[model samples]
Target: YFQSHPAIQPATVVVEDRAHPSTSELSPTWNRTDEWYNYRSNPRERVHVLAALDESSYTGGTMNGDHPIAWCQDYQGGRAFYTGLGHTKESYADPAFRGHLLGGIRYATGHTQADCRPENGYRPLFDGTAESLADWKQAGPGSFTRSDDGTLTSSGGMGMLWYPGQDLGSYSLKLDWKMASASGDDNSGVFVGFPPSDDPWSAVDNGYEIQIDATDVPEKTTGSVYGFRSADLKKRDRALNPPGEWNTYEIR
Candidate 1:
């Protein structure tokens, strides 16, 4: 599917050994033969991998489903899009859903016409850089360290980084993300319309958080613009590569 879709390139791909179930799937009494699980559970490794992939392909998001749905971000600002509507053969044949996916790709890849209406206009502020890390400095009291494996890790409460010097008054901000797993509440998401001085918590209180948590309540999963509106993702699948794999995300 990727090779044929030349307009969309595979940025950072992960081909994990699928012969075994994830550690979360194994019982404690089982042989416990998977050492890879230990390596994957390391936060520093995870962040490094995420940052590396993000830098390489301009993709930042998770794919928790069993099927391969491309999560992508636009290099330009103002739109983030995801479509979990690719699990079934019938869905693959649905023109409307396919249009949505293609539209998202076009928007992210810089091929779509922009809708400049106040409510729909997107003005990109941050382009994802080492300087962007400065925004998180105010997040307060978190350790930022590179692991032996070269992944960046941050522990403690939530932190955030946003494009500085902009107030998105009436633009639409889209985020595409997936949970790291099918169970447990390992939540992560995009924070939108936040004040430059604010942290993730303030964004949650004043702005909005479009949740990517699949296990969250239906109102909060996939396309939900956290606490405001819900995306109508009718079907669900869990064929995504395990947690350590790269998932694409687009936030406009």
Candidate 2:
């Protein structure tokens, strides 16, 4: 139930995000035999989808033609990856299948990097580079310092970095980030739906936030849509990389 977008039906998935390390080792349209489970929604444009079901290859598929079967995302300060494969016990014994699993683990653990940028008409909101932040406007007190490696580490007070170039309507925004704190107790979040304002409190009153403090309750912790909703803790835990590791988040 925690899976944001589950599988459509037990069938094979066609690799779409071919550049990702996990799917890069496989053929573009490899097929597998597994029990696919349907998800509540299609996570397309919301994640870097590695594989999708070739609807033509399956009969009961229902995500139009752009069905994602496996994907990776940056959750609140941690990596989040999901794949709807390996239902049957025999899947574990298959060498090709095992390799796929290993590649995913490598990408998730930050042992390797992948081009997880979300496509589907989404543009960079914050790409961890100074050029990307040319129009970024900070509000509140503390600050995030940009490093030579294109990472923004928190250094100052409590504030927010927002895009000031244009007004965002309905679009998927993706970013890669990492919390340097070892205990994962950092205070960070992504706010949406609020207009540009000098006072950060305006955001607090008008916008919704996806919090990054990983040590709180399900409703108030990392991956939570603030106090209104809680991420599925079990699924979140499985997908999260620890502090000091890079993670990605795609907010739609």
Candidate number with greatest lDDT = 2
Whole-model lDDT, model 1: 0.39
Worst 10 residues of 2 by lDDT: 1-10
lDDT by residue (182-234, candidate 1, tens digit) is 46355766777666664556777887776656666766765478777776665
TM-score of each: 0.40, 0.56
Off by over 4 Å in 1: 1-136, 141-154, 165-184, 235-242
Give one digit per residue, the lDDT tens place, for model 2 in 181-216: 899997778899997897788888999998888998
